[model samples]
Target: MLLALYAALGVVALPRLLSQVAWFERAPRLAIAMWQAACASVVVSALLAALAVAVPASVLGHGLADFFEACATLLSHGVPFTSASARIALLLAGVLVVRITYCAACVLLSARRERRRHAEMLAIVGRHDSRLGAMVVDYDECMAYCLPGRHGLPVITTGALRTLTSAQTAAVLAHEHAHLRGRHHLVLAAVRTLVRAFSGAPLFARASSEIARLVELLADDVAARGHPRVHIAAALVGLATGRVPDFALGAGGETALVRVRRLLDPVEPLRQRERLVGILTIGVLLAGPAAVAAMPGVRAFLAHYCESFIF
Candidate 1:
């Protein structure tokens, strides 16, 4: 029963452990109540696990129980966030390091180039497609759309103008413009930044991929606003091509196969389930140490484990 409890506790905490890596990815859209319920479940499970561990089974249990109680208390005391040795502090510092590095790299390497590219793209608008546009550059294989200052940034490529029919161009323009108007870049950038922070974790990579898809789906949602499905589908097919260079205007990021179908068929919407999972996961992880402090049986279990090692 105690072993079973410990296992359950570990299972409950799994989502939380991954959430620090997941939430910053493509956060799902789900109900608040469900989110909180899952969080509570994780906490309760972890605490129960600790309780099981702390329960003594035999006559030699007293000293081991004492040791476990002490360890549990220390673990539950909450990490000394101000100290570098503290787990919470270390985690925070690691995230900050990633953020600063990302910011620095953007400022030094990508920002200026982006600015120059935006200006150039804007100037060449007349030579390309003219309506419903934003200059979302495909720099470094990452697709990003930018809204020009104040007025709508009508992004036009000479190729899109020549290759696509007027309606197709309009569809593409609407999609990109939706991205600019909607401030989609903020969400996308935030997810990527998080992905970089948790790069060591496998979940982070998966989150990054999901986030990229969600952003595109979000844009497609916008473009689909009062537009024909065929138009949107054609425009997507038009811009996203394998042969296109990363520096040019393109629309190929994540999950192209799925996205094309969604655009054509028009699903209800992207739900918040992913986001809910993410929040709950983080909650469990943050609560893990706290449970040890609160649960007596878990304290006993750990004490025995420690003493067994000693003996």
Candidate 2:
């Protein structure tokens, strides 16, 4: 029942609710964590629910030991599932497995190809900037972003260097550095993979966009540590029209205007109590599916213990 509710919420409620929440813009890190937790919880709960429905409660209630024995027996004896529910569950699980595997492969191959292409471009046209710890490109478009790899090179355009003030440039560098350090591109890639897998699912589509925005906000926050918020905002404005590479984490994107406004008119960080609540919520989101999945095993263990004591 809990799993059902989770699935429904993931499909129906979460996409709308998360997108409408304005406070998340102010608490980007917490928001990122929550989005990730939500995605993970949905997938895990769906898989667990399928397994729960496929395997008889009677067998599961006897604990992990009994559950495995039953599986072994079925495999050895070539017994077919008797219940219609079990057959449906098995079909759903198989479909999910194939979808997840294909999506993962697509994401990996795409990322690898893009990275190689960008790395080759960098080697050909990029110059080392020892002062800024980045690779300077001679493009006229104002741009600053990071190309993630083993060394994670920061790529800055000549136009950006010419346009931005010294402080603004520093802020942009810090922002890109934050993306590299946090490995935010990987997060975006995962969410994107899910979106690609479930193109029709609003939750995946919304999550992909939200997570992308949140990561930029997070990078902005990190950049704020060393530079004035105004400088970061200015840098964002200057680079707002710049085009980023497909595989790069850029200082500007679709949300550049909103981010500039956020930097200029900053909201107070979440209160400690609020942050604590958010953390607890994330914990519950992750742990709830696991608990539901394990309940039968837990019950079986306790029942066995009681029976042994009586014997």
Candidate 3:
């Protein structure tokens, strides 16, 4: 039952609620953390629920010793699943593991391929820019973005160099630098992997889009530390129509217009108390499902020890 609730929340409730939350737009880092916690909680809760169903209460009642024995039985001849529910749970667990692993591999491999291709392109057509501390690609498009890897390089186009003022260019570079510094691409890649693996799942799709947007907002925040918000907004406008490689984090994209508006009309930063509350909320969202999932084992442990003491 707990597992079902978690699955429902992950697949339906949380995604819908989060999509509608305007506060998340104001506090993007907190929002990112919440999304991550929510995703992890759902996965963990689902696995625990599967285990709970597969291993009978009789086995769990005997505590850790019997738990390991049951695991060994499962590995050897497989446990005699007396109930259809047990068989279904075991099957679900297997499917989850395989799905997650395959999706992760796909994401990694695809990223590597993209990076390799981009690197080759950069080697041929890209020039080093000491002033900007980035690679200058001699393209006509007004673009600025960063390709992330061991040899991660920020790239700006000749067109962008002509289009943006010195301050605007600085702001754009700062934004891309933040992306590279924070390793934001990995966060995006992970969510995207889940989406690819579960193409039918609206939750993963929503998560992918939301996380991507939040990371952009986060990068904007970082850039704002070093450059005027107005300059950054201007840079966003200058680069709004520019194109970057699919794998790269660009200064302008679908969120650019909204980001520009945000920069121009910035909201006050969250108060310390509000930040604390947000942190606590993330903690509860992550821990609640886990605690609920562990209850059966905890209860069984207490019951077994109490029975022993009584005897």
Best by lDDT: 2
Q: Between the candidate structures 1 and 2, which one is better when assessed by lDDT?
A: 2
Give the distance in Å from residue 118's predicted Cα in candidate 1 to where it truly belongs.
3.9
Query: Candidate 2: which stretches are off by over 4 Å?
Result: 72-78, 241-254
Q: All models: lDDT?
A: 0.51, 0.85, 0.84
- Report the C-alpha lDDT of model 2 over 1-311, residue by residue, as the tens digit: 57867876786677787777667988999999988888888888988888888886667777668889999998899798898888899889889889988998899788978998998989898899999899999998787879997778789999889888888899999999999999998899888888888788778888888899899999999999999999999888777644453556554455877898889998899889888988998998899998998887678778877988999
> Best candidate, TM-score-wise?
3
Per candidate, the number of residue pairs that clash is 20, 0, 0
TM-score of 1: 0.49
Write one digit per residue (lDDT tens) for candidate 1, span 1-311: 34335445544453455345432222233222223333334334443443434333332245556656754765699534333334443354355556647754664456346656767666664333223434433233312244433444655545555556778766667777776676655544544554554455343344445555656666666776757868878766765652356465334544666678876775654347765555565565456544543455455557867988999
Candidate 2 lDDT (Cα, 0 to 1)? 0.85
> Could you report the Cα RMSD, in angstroms, for every candidate shown?
11.5, 3.5, 3.4
**Which has the better TM-score: candidate 2, or candidate 3?**
3
Worst 10 residues of 1 by lDDT: 25-34
Each candidate structure's TM-score, on Cα atoms with residue i matched to residue i, is 0.49, 0.89, 0.90
